[model samples]
Target: MDYLLAILIIVYVALMILVGYIAWKHTSNSEDYLVAGRQSNSYIMALSYGATFISTAAIVGFGGLAGTNGLGILWLVFLNIAVGIFIAFVIFGKPTRKMGQYLNALTFPEFLSKRFNSKFIQYFSGLLIFLTMPIYAASVLIGAARFVETTINIDFNLAILILAIIIGFYVIFGGIKGVMYTDALQGTIMFLGMLILLISIYSMLGGVTHAHELLSSMAPLFPESAKVTGATGWTTFPTTGSPFWWNLVSSIILGVGIGAIAQPQLAVRFMTVKSNKELNRAVLVGGIFIFVTTFTAYVVGALSNVYFYQTTGQIAIQAAGGNVDKIIPTFINSAMPKWFTYIFLLTLLSAAMSTISTQFHVQGSSIAHDVYCAIKNRSSLRITRIGILIAIIIAVVLAYILPGNIVATGTSIFFGICAVAFLPVYLCALFWKRTTKLGAIAGIVSGTVSSLFCLLFTYKKVAAGLGICKFLTGKAVLFSGMPWPYVDPMVIALPIAFIFTIGVSLLTKNSKEEEIAIEKMFKAEEGA
Candidate 1:
């Protein structure tokens, strides 16, 4: 079985390398490297976007979470379609594509900088992406690494190191073209793998109704520790008003859902296409892709609990020895046929690599193209490739050091920060001609600082698990006594940033020239 799995993986890796080589051959300039020369078709763009957005975090981290949390986590699946695919592509996609082309903006920060006519916005936003994005990138690395380590029985550190090197090589060599081309392939693999896994699980558990019935019947079997944190069962929502409920709704669901709009990596996809027509055509493909991938994972993951309990007399979480991160992979290893296990492992690998490649590409562009090239007034493809290498090293180290629940933790933190810092500014840049430089700057600064402070000092995970704040505060979380222990920072920081952005914009004014630039940006806006 191991030998057969290795053969399958080797074939997949060869295919990925071939794709990277093809992309590298065609990538002759910075434009091709950054945005695929803005010529990708709707199919390639949509699949790449879906693949990049739905990463190992969704399949491994969130899937494992669903094993314990129940189908309620499907809210994220719904939101991924509604907000992430529909609103993002249909509503924001057209304006973003138009303005990005108008401003000659290849990167998200560059878009903001040119739209607002502020180098400060460009440099600062680029710096933020460079500095803070690695944590999220690391989370993705960890998710894939864990699966590889468990499925192949390899060392965790070794698995992460190998995975990082392979992903970094292609990303550094092929750039966005490589990332997107490979993303389309990876997305296809993930769709097939998840669909199969879902079907097999339902069949194993005697179909959806029987599986869910068994799961709902085990509500009384909820672990004592979980119960204390307000876990009612795998079949129901977290206990309302409990710490777990706040963590689920506010931190996990809302954070990632809202944050999807402002993701630097995902935003760059709009600039990769030629027109809104591609985006419009992409909506259905992207939506179906996201739906199949996430809906299947969450349902199958939740149903895994029923499968495990019946087969092993142990709940999924308990069977994995209390680490939810291990539940999904372990369940597959234990419950599935050998051939299917090998195939599912490919899906896991594709999920991690697609997302990780995008992160590396985005980080590379932010540092090299957005920051260095903008300042130097020259673009160096060599420097961008080098930046990708550096980012991989940093992310690999972080992935090695981070502990359990790293996927969800990293996703929430990055998403929360991005939402707070970029969402208001991004929306205003697209729709509001009155968004002054000062307002944009103020909103970004306040949002970044507030979110970071809360994440480090007020969130229990960082305070305790990371120990960054324990030295000063002598407690895991400074706000441990607050109404909700794990409420995501977006709850507080997003509103503050939005209010400041609106208030500051209303009080201040844009120059006539700047106002004209803003108006020209939206002249082709479909929804505006």
Candidate 2:
């Protein structure tokens, strides 16, 4: 790591702090803090949305995932654009914006609680967000710091703390305006860095034709373990019933695709826009952003393996650090020019920071605005700042103690949990006419408990790694289980929650209060 390069990176961090300082002026209330006063234009909205959604999980996890999974991982980029961005803006964005406006709800929990009529739903959902988001945030911290420490040679713990403090305080002070403004800027860095990396790699490998030909000839670059796992070659395409295929099709694509529609962090962007037309405008920009950035990232992640194989005849299996997580950084250090590697480090740091800030922000307000404020009737910036502080502390602790693939696993668990606990009650609040409060409560409990139980007792890595699952389930249930498969727990739990909600609702007659709530939703929606 050159001194000049390290200085350059540190300067960028300072500039980000300055941006957050600027955002402090814009936020005066809960609305401003949470959703930028609901006035972000399409460009800001789209870029910010894209940056936040493309977290360290996408770069660190997905890039390494590509090394092992091969071209098959390309499926994720398509899903991100189509389901994560495009349809998210079209289908989910519109309704979320309309209802958020009608209910004056700033957080997802607030939206669901206001839409339905349950305090338990609001507080419990907030608890879930607060609990899981830190694990995700810690993962983001770990990813950003790992790259910085390796590329620049900073201590691991020091880098993690510095990054966390900067992001935490910036978000705590600047709120949504700061988050979006910086995200848009970071999105540009990510795009340009990837562009440079791809062009350089292909050019170095003797152009596209030579590179592809060399890569294709080495079909055995992929190990036999991949085939048993149900994958073709990483350089080639996917095969049938492979874990890779099931993971791509069933878990990654379908799980995240359907799940993105319900993501609170992204959904808030719809509320931030000034009008439906702005959201409509955002789809084009968002589509282009996703296409370019994600396209470049997936391309780089997949093809880096090709580059490695052709150059060293050694597979991507931890030649440098012995961990898959280091694959991209190792590639940058070895394959890319020093200047570009520096920029790529910034690119990754920015991506990780952008998403971590949002996660922390969302987690804080879920506690402050949705759970605490709804009960306590407090919404001061000071109270929100305290909430942010508490959330950051928890996340920071997690960052130090244990973190690997934390963001990815946390995402699977978080999204799965949200899908189960929030999805059924949320949709009912918006569209269903006959949903009862009893049903909503039943759904929340069943979904949350079921998902936790599955993640604990059934997911082998999660259970064995934590050891608490072993204690609760004892040896038999722990050792005998098939382990949570490719499908996130949401796959099973969501349906059960919906069933529990609907079955109970159908059995019970709607109270006049429930009728009035439905009528109000329709009336407000029609007028809007």
Which candidate gets the maximum lDDT versus the true structure? 1
Candidate 1's TM-score reads 0.97
lDDT of each: 0.87, 0.76
Task: Looking at model 2, report the run of 10 residues with the lowest lDDT sum.
Answer: 476-485
**Residue 338 deviation, candidate 1, in Å?**
0.6
- How many clashes in each structure? 0, 1
For model 2, name the residue pairs that clash: 230-242
- RMSD over all Cα atoms, model 1: 1.7
Model 1 Cα lDDT, one tens digit per residue, 1-528: 367987898899999999999999999998899989999999999999999999989988888889877777889988899999999998888888888887788899999998889988888998899899998999988888888888888899998988888887789999999999999999999999988987888888888788789889988987887799889988788888888888888887899988999999999999999777899999999999999999887887788778788788998888888787888888989998878888889999999999999999998788888888889988899988988888888898888778787787788889889999999999998888888999999889889999888877787756577677788878777876755347788898999899888889899999988887677667745433
- The true-versus-predicted C-alpha distance at residue 449 of model 1, in Å, is 0.5
Q: Which pairs clash in model 1? A: none
| Overall local distance difference test of candidate 2 | 0.76
